[model samples]
Target: MCPTSPSASIFGINTVHRMSLQSALIGFLISRMLPTPLTPQQIIVVQTTAVATGTMPLAAGFVGILPALGLLSEERDGTPPIHLTWLSAVGWSCSVAFFGVFLSPPLRKQVIIEEQLAFPSGTATAQLISVLHKLPPPDTSIRSRRGYLHLDTEDDSAEPTGRSPSSPQPIDTETDADINEREFVQHEGWHALTYSFLASSIMTLIAYFFPILFSIPLFGNYLAKEWLWTFTPSLSYVGQGIIMGFPTAVSMNLGMLVGWAVLSPLSKSQGWAPGAVGDMTNGARGWILWTSLAIMCADSVVSLFPVVYEYFSDLYRAQILRRGDSSSKEDHEVETEDRLVPYTWVTAGLLISIFVGTILVWVVFGNEGIKPWATVLGFILGGMLSVLGVRALGETDLNPVSGLGKISQLFFAWIQPGNVVANIIAGGVAEAGAQQAGDLMQDLKTGHLCKASPRAQFLGQMIGSSVSILVTATAYSLYTRAYPIPGPSFPAPTAYVWLSLARLLRDGQLPEKSGVFMFAFAIVFGLVSASKTYAARRQSPIAKWIPSGVAFAIGFLNTPSFSLARLVGGIMDYVYRTRYARDGNDISLIVVASGFVLGEGVISVVSLVLRTFGVGVISCWGCGHGLCGGCPAV
Candidate 1:
């Protein structure tokens, strides 16, 4: 929300609704810092439910281009006057959410638990949760090592066994001494996380109060001195850098080097620049902004070629090759409380949501558009597209909902040409359905790792979705009335992109206004990126040096502050990897980083709320979001 650049990502909630859970996970750890630490399962239940609750807002809000399209639509008085109705928008969004819920179980079986696609982000979340909650084996030694941070574990799978030095009454068994030892480990873990939280919070507070430390353009005052680079220190981004591995760091920084250090300055000198390379506000909205978009949006579909083919081929083996006898050992093992939602409930929910959605659309639009056949088509497309969406989510952390939605819109527009409302509803279903399903599956993955019940997680998702219906509806009405989207205060750039596409499609051609070179370059780069990604999987030594298109796109458009903060985080993790931890992804580092993310995120949300209520936070003239003067004493 704070990003002033047009090239900024829309917070990526469609496929990975992670920030809230990330925060909640750390919040849970912080709670345990000075109090009784609940079991891992207990913390998981709270985190999943809390995270699940935030997903509806993703569908409701204009995070991606799909939800934001309505901002561009308007009702003009004329014969057969038509406009997108708020009721229809809310109703259809809810329907898509439910559709995701029902479709997720089967997808979970085929893709997640069975095929085991490397949903890296979800896998990382699961690993973090398991590590945080895992009680050390009873027979494990708890000797003081280098410092409180060092766990001194021989293995992640460390367990106690028969030992002559130990007594016959095994220490690994249920005993008072073992229980106390376990408590000590848990307490120490909490202590370390809390200290990290405090340290991160203090640093963040300093930046907010004194902008000299962060968020200022380097080498000059706002413009004309250096490339458009800000020294913004994002606590959450630092945490993100910790999670993504070293190859990712190098790839992303390489992009920043090329775009910022090279191309940006060159563009400005030639007078073909996007803006002042040093200005943080609109400097990033340069010609390269479009170039970055060409890479990101085009590569989203390009990368999906392999994933979509694999997805359908797997289905073919299950249905045609095996005659629909597709079952696995893990499914049977998970029957008790961790199995898929019942077939009847899922079926009923799907039917009801579809029916409700159609009725709501018809009622709101009054037969001006929105056909029943369109609704059915929407259901089919949404379900199919979800496979592509979740697969992209698993393999890469990128969400393809917006790209997939545009494709659906293109298809549906041809089917019912000139019916904007119908196309939007149809496209919205495809986009939102996949978006919700991807989100739920990520939650399910975390639960699976924590040994929590899948059935329980499904129920939690339903509860969260049901609540989101009311919450999202109210939020939409309130936020729109307050600031309005696509406006200066709430510039929904993604929505603008969607609407711009719609307009161009109506004219039956892409914009011919001199971007061919950029497009050609992007397409070629995207292809090369895709090829390199595939080749890298074969253990090619050269693969390590290949610049990831995804990382490059992020770094290419975003200010150096964004990349540098993440770089620092990566450097920090590498430091730990070399000296402190067995791997860069030590549980201790994750715990601390999680604390950093949660502490800052919580405070920012608070500041937003206070500002919303017309209460002055930290503000001053000539200040780029810095606390300038002393606050009025409370």
Candidate 2:
């Protein structure tokens, strides 16, 4: 049987109580299991539990189960056991211990430099602190050469009458202390925990439940046709615009339209129907699989180049400039500042590693047996498309799997119409999963600030996500069993290999409109790329124009209602940010938002549980509606 779901209670009371219980349990278990006292580093290892257990475990479980069930692999009707073994538990425990020990020294050094030294903010550690607690603004004044020179005289005498006239008065310690205390009270401790929990819960709930709501009538049907109309003159839309910074959201929505609605439908109409070109015996599907993998690999390689360049530049600058200086002790002293890894480098490395690992797994495990040349070409195309994908959607701060999935969908649509629908669904699931993981990160950040064990947070996420799996799997199974997609409808990739061959046959013509379209598309793409670069360098007006243009294009292309929903979300986000900014960070709004998110997530879990028991209820409509028929009538 699956693990028992946590007892439902009100946010503050239930959560705090449950956490306290869990913490005690962990402490007790550690004392009984371990032979020695855990070092500070080992203590920190607990944090990994937060990641390991949540979405990661859920994802792993899904991957494991899917292949066994024939939904994902050749194996059929096999069920993996769900028992938690002794060896597995020990491995997890050791991993947590090692992570804490390895991370502590750096973390400790950061705390001292950042907290005690009173250094200026904006460093990685500082940002973490700020997110964890309220921090005073950075000191913006430049240290003048003359001021440094005169510092000795000021220190030598209580009253230095000969000090430079331009020297600014020293800060009043008492007043500064009072201000710092107030800031700390406002940002750190319980307040930070509250905000983190709220933000994470809300984001998670929305990611999980929005798709379900999107399927309901009036709202779902309307948004699927007229996306923009839903958001016209709406405050929520305006708010969303402000919070997401307009450009990113607009671009992402436009991408969805171009990929899903337009390309998908067009592919089907071009004689790319299933079973028309090749039989399963010809190994046609293997070619498409290899093609997709190649694209993913190329994209990963392109993404890594920037990171390598940045690292080398930093190494050169450090070794050649400051330490290499001859003949000046003073200059050497001034140059010997702490080394740091730039945020850009970290971001790039993370993206490249994730995509590369994913592609490797797919290529090695996938059933496809395409040619080496085709794989290489696919990789190059995937990499080229990566740039376009980023511009189209903005940065997700989530997993790159969904982005790659989208690229696959677009490419497959060009090759075979029958694969379009399956690709879209896959993209959606991958994206949604990443979004859920991101929500967990927000929570983990909060937990980090609050001195909560990272391991605990990881465990919490695993527990939470595992709950989702049980619910989602059962619901999906029942729903599909009750109302499977009919014949002639899309077969969801597994049902047909002929779809790919049909696409190849239809597009086999050499001197066709497709080629013409490709040339024109290339030109348009070059113009956009050039424009974006200029905007980045010069902060040109086009920076605003392009995203807006994309948004307008999407408004025309997609259902007005879906666009309307996005606009509504944007507007609400804008207002929330504005209000929070004005109130000087009350933390209450964050809590309220978190409540909404948690409520939504909890409801989803409930729905899933009910479905597993064979109880059916009408799902709620979109964000605008709170409750309909999903909840049992009192």
In TM-score terms, which candidate is top? 1
Instruction: Report lDDT (CA) for all predictions.
Output: 0.57, 0.32
Candidates' RMSD to native: 8.5, 13.9
Q: Kindly give the number of clashing pairs for every candidate.
A: 3, 51
Model 1 lDDT tens row, 295-315: 666666677777777666766
Best model number under lDDT: 1
Each prediction's TM-score versus the true structure: 0.74, 0.42
Model 2 per-residue lDDT at 362 = 38
| Candidate 1 TM-score over all chains jointly | 0.74
- What's the true lDDT of residue 113 in model 1? 56
Candidate 2 structure quality by residue, lDDT tens digits, 437-493: 332333333333334454444444445444444443443344333322211111122
lDDT for position 104 in model 2: 23
